[model samples]
Structures are given as C-alpha cells and as structure tokens.
Target: MQNLPTSWSTPVGALTATGIGGVAMAVAALAVTADPAGRFLIGLAALGLLVVTALGLRQRPRLAIRDGNRGIVLQRLGGRLDVDRTELRRVRIVRYPRLGRRVPMLEIDVRPPGADDDRLLVFGRWDLGTDPTNVFDALNARGLVPPDPHRTPDR
Candidate 1:
C-alpha cells in the first residue's frame, strides 16, 4: 500500500502569484483606462482578487494532522481550531454539481470537548490544493476517521 500525506494545505505560490497579478491589473486599469466606469469595474475585480489572496496567506498551512494521531489543526481567518481524535465523529467526501462538473469537499464532523453538538467543517479542493478524496483516503489510512461502507471505492 502507498503511504499518504498527513497534512494538506493551500499552495502559497499560487496565492502570491494571484496577488501580484491583481496588483498589475489594478495599475494597468488606473494608468491606461480612459473610461471611468471601466476603470472602476476593473479596479473592483482586482481589489477582490487581492482580498482573497490576503485571506489565503493569512491562513497558511490550513489543515494539519498532529503526530501520534493526536488530532487535526485547522487554521482559519481569526484563529485556529484543534480537534482531537476523540472529537472527530465522522469524515467523508461530499460531491456537488458545479458548472456541469462534480466538485468534491471534505466534510469533518466533530464534537469538541464539552460541546453538546457536533460541528461540521468543510474543506474544498481550493483549500487543500488537491482532491478531497485524496485527503479522505489519507485520513482513513491514518485511522483518524472510520471507513464508510456506503462509499464506493471508485472515487
């Protein structure tokens, strides 16, 4: 059997490239565009791209599985969440149709210590910089989550 990675994260290079592109676009829009409305629209789009890049950079190394199967750490906008092995209730891949293609997301259900209800955390391909199915398989290999009998192996 092949060994799988224990951690998954968004590519920093991709985000940095996007930020640079956004800056170039913004500059070009302001310097070359003669129409005020066109410049405003282009600038708005560039700003949005920069904002996304900033957020992505802020949450570097988005998800990681701790050593000894202790838990998984998730970094978000404001802070990080640590979910122990005991807290993890379920992990599965969910697929949804988008633009005539199926997009997969990894859904982790966890009940934190002293928490009465379970919270569902979803990570998309963009978040992991890879297919969620691959992450799911890695989690399964590490025995962090139980195997789903209903899920087909073809994925």
Candidate 2:
C-alpha cells in the first residue's frame, strides 16, 4: 500500500514544549534546594513529566492514515496505530463545533471483532497532506468507505 503524506506541526510543538518544560523543571529543582527529600520529590516529578512527554512525542496526534494491505494505519510521530480492515465500519466527513463555527474533519468509526461499541478516530485537514475530500474519495474508490445513505445526491 502507498504511504500517505502527513503534517506534524501541532503535535510536534506540544512535544517540544513538554520536553523543554520537563527538563527545565528538573534543572530548577536541582538549583532551588539542597534538602534530600524535597529534591527527590522534585526530581521524581520532573522525571515523570519527561517520561510522559517522551512517550507522547513518540505517538503524537498529528498523523496520517495509510491503507495497509489488511488494514489502515494511523501514522503518528514515531509509531503507528493499525486498525484491521475488519475493524473498520465507516468513514465520513463531519463538521466539528470549534470557535463557534463548524470545521470539517474526517471521522472514522471502527468496531473490532468482539467490541461492543464503535471507536472513533478523528483527523483534521492538516493531518492529511492533501484535502480530506481527496483522501475520502480514494478510500471510497477502493471500497473502504461505504456511501452515506442519508447523503443527498447533490453532495
């Protein structure tokens, strides 16, 4: 399967900030006090922050979705979330209520073999290298996305 291009600004920025903040806090703790217990607690907190930030950076949200041979992969910062083809149920474009207006977003609803409820994966336009419409069209062409019964013909 061909890999889709992706964008990674928002998540990268977040990761960068978290990493810098974590390190700064750790350094500040060392400089602030010489007491063992206080320094220990601060060190622990800083370590926790750094660890969480590192993990998040590895799987940051700004991603790309690529069609795999047997499933679709949500390509993240340094990892990929692979959803089996069988798990995928529907793909549609929806409007999100943001900043008092509706913004277009792609929503993929999936239900794994034994799951009771659907899991939703949402992606913004920036996530895809191209337009969401183009991605949708390509997926639809490959029979990955079923037509929306409620959608009007003009749409």
Candidate 3:
C-alpha cells in the first residue's frame, strides 16, 4: 500500500512494480509446476523479462531538489529517448486524483516525432523542477536550456 504515492511516483513506483513482478513470477511458477516439460520454457522467458526490467529500473531519476537541465536526453541502459529543449512541447502539473472520488497521478508529458502524443517527463506533482509552482525556474537556473514556446503559460 505504501508503494504508490499521490504526490510522487518514484519509490512507490519501484515498489509497486516489484510487487506486480513478484506476482507474475508466482503465476509463471504455478504454470511451470503443472507442466514439467514446459517449465523450462516459462522459466527461461521469466528470466529474460527480469533481466530487461532490472536494466530499465536503473534509469530512475534522482529526487534531489536541485535544478537540472530543463530538457534532458533520456535513455535506458543503451537506448536513447528523444528529448531536448527544442523537442519540449509542453510542461504542466496534471492532476490524476479527486477528493474521495478518484486516484491521482503526477506527470508531465512530452510530445515527440511520430509520437505526436505521449508522456515525456513525469515525476511527482508536488515535486516541481524549481521554485514554487514554477518548473521553469529549474530550467532557468540551469542556464543550459533555451526558451521553449511550449513552456509558455497561457496569459
């Protein structure tokens, strides 16, 4: 239960994923137990999945309260994610919870090539990039990013 936070999805995300992963392992174990010969195949597949997810888990962002590059080039182990200041299309604190009626999610989606619509950067809601409710503050302080049209607030 302490594996999913309404404000940030870091520690909770990891724990929640692990929990589900354990459950999946148990299911596979059961399937293998019922079929002796097929057990090897399922076991091999599970091992492969575990290896992949473990590598991806290494890319979890740091929660340190400091200013980092406004836009970053993300990658997993060896794969690259398309993200740069120029590719940044929008940044906002999106709400995923309601007062006693819905669950919550803290995320900032980034759009990209062919991926016209997809979540880009997502950390926690209360966890901002910089001072106050201004994520731009983080970027500005970094002094490594340029003004992005998508980051402009609707005034």
Best by TM-score: 1
Candidate 3 whole-model C-alpha lDDT, 0 to 1: 0.47
RMSD of 2: 5.8
Model 2: lDDT equals 0.66
Model 2, runs deviating above 4 Å: 1-14, 21-52, 60-69, 74-81, 125-143, 152-155
Count of clashes, each model: 0, 0, 3
Q: Is candidate 2 or candidate 3 better by TM-score?
A: 2
Estimate, for each residue in 67-108, the C-alpha lDDT of model 2 and write its tens digit: 343556675555666777678888887777889988777788
TM-score for each prediction? Answer: 0.88, 0.53, 0.38
lDDT of 1 by residue, 1-155 (tens): 24677777778888988899899889977886578988898898899889989988888678888887788889999799888888988898889899999899899988988989999999998899889988887887788886556766664
Q: How close is candidate 2 to the true structure, as a TM-score?
A: 0.53
Clashing pairs in 2: none
Candidate 1 backbone collisions, by pair: none
Error of 3 at 119 (Å): 6.4
What residue runs in model 3 are displaced by over 4 Å at the alpha carbon? 1-58, 62-70, 76-78, 98-104, 109-155
lDDT of each: 0.85, 0.66, 0.47
lDDT winner between 2 and 3, please give it. 2
